[model samples]
Target: MLEMYRSYLAACNERAWDTIAEFLHPSVLVNGIPRTREQYVDDIRKTIAVFPDYAWQLRHVVQQPPWLAVHLHATGTRHQDFLGAPGDLSPVETDEFAMYRIADGRIAELWGTADNARLRLSTHNETR
Candidate 1:
């Protein structure tokens, strides 16, 4: 399961949407967002476009039967527009975590949250 998670992050950083598809269940739910495989691919593309060098640093991993939770620190620079926000050279870092539910050896669902305050501080120079 850790290997799968590592591969998933690699695929995400490399913007390999096709490769990412292999690790996800056909109907994967990310956070509260239910997405089809194509939708997932689209979201990944948009993310990579926004943060060209996005990378994740694994902090810890915990496993329970049928579930895996990962604590990660993600860092990147904005290089392209995203969700109407223009790119900036300022580096952004956020502590994020995700809990994945595995079914049949594939990721069936993910619930994730990130340090939005830190991200906004680093990127937009705003505090929340």
Candidate 2:
């Protein structure tokens, strides 16, 4: 199961959405973001466009029946426009953690958290 997560991350880092699809269930729910498979793929593509050098460093993995929690640090430069904001303002490094429900050896659902305060500060230069 940990290997599956690793492979998924590797595919994501490589912008290989097709490879990612291979490890996800047809009904996969990513980070509680209600998107279909195609939408999910598009989201990833947009993310990579915004953070071209985005890299994920897996910190820890905990596996249990029907679930896996993954802690990771995602860091990258904001090199392109993202979410209606311009890019190249500065590099942003954020820590993110995700908990996933695995079913039939594939990712079925996911919930995630990130350094939102840091992201906001880096995105708009405002402290919250």
Candidate 3:
């Protein structure tokens, strides 16, 4: 299961948006919010657009039946404003923690947390 999860991350890095169904359930929820597969791909695209050269460095992975928790560090340079909403094109190194609930051998739900305020504050000076 861990290996599958890693492959999913690698696929995201490759921007293989079309292959997501191989890993995720159709009713997947991100942080408890319902998301369609298209929305998931869009979210991945946004992350890729903002951090074009980022790497998902894994810190730890622990798996118990039906659940996997991953601690990761997403470090990279920001190439553009993020979210197409509000963000800065400044360097960023954020720690992200995620938990996946697995069902029927696919990811059923995901709850992820990442630190963003530090990045925002780091770029605040540049924008000012």
Top-scoring candidate (TM-score)? 1
lDDT of 3 by residue, 1-128 (tens): 88888888888767677776678787789998998767877787877777776678788999996999999887666776654424455666778999999888888899988886544544435443
lDDT of each: 0.79, 0.76, 0.76
TM-score of decoy 1:
0.84
Candidate 3 Cα RMSD after full superposition onto the native fold (Å): 3.7
Per-residue CA lDDT of model 2 for 17-71, tens digit only, reads 8988877777677766565666767777876777788788999888886889888
Q: Identify the runs in model 2 with alpha carbons over 4 angstroms from their true place.
A: 31-34, 81-86, 120-128
Residue 57 displacement (Å), model 1 = 1.5
How many steric overlaps are in each model, in order? 0, 0, 0
- For residue 27, model 2's alpha carbon misses the true position, in angstroms, by 1.7
Candidate 2 structure lDDT: 0.76
Off by over 4 Å in 1: 81-86, 123-128
What is the descending lDDT order? 1, 3, 2
What TM-score, computed on C-alpha atoms, does each candidate reach?
0.84, 0.82, 0.82
Give me candidate 2's TM-score against the actual structure.
0.82
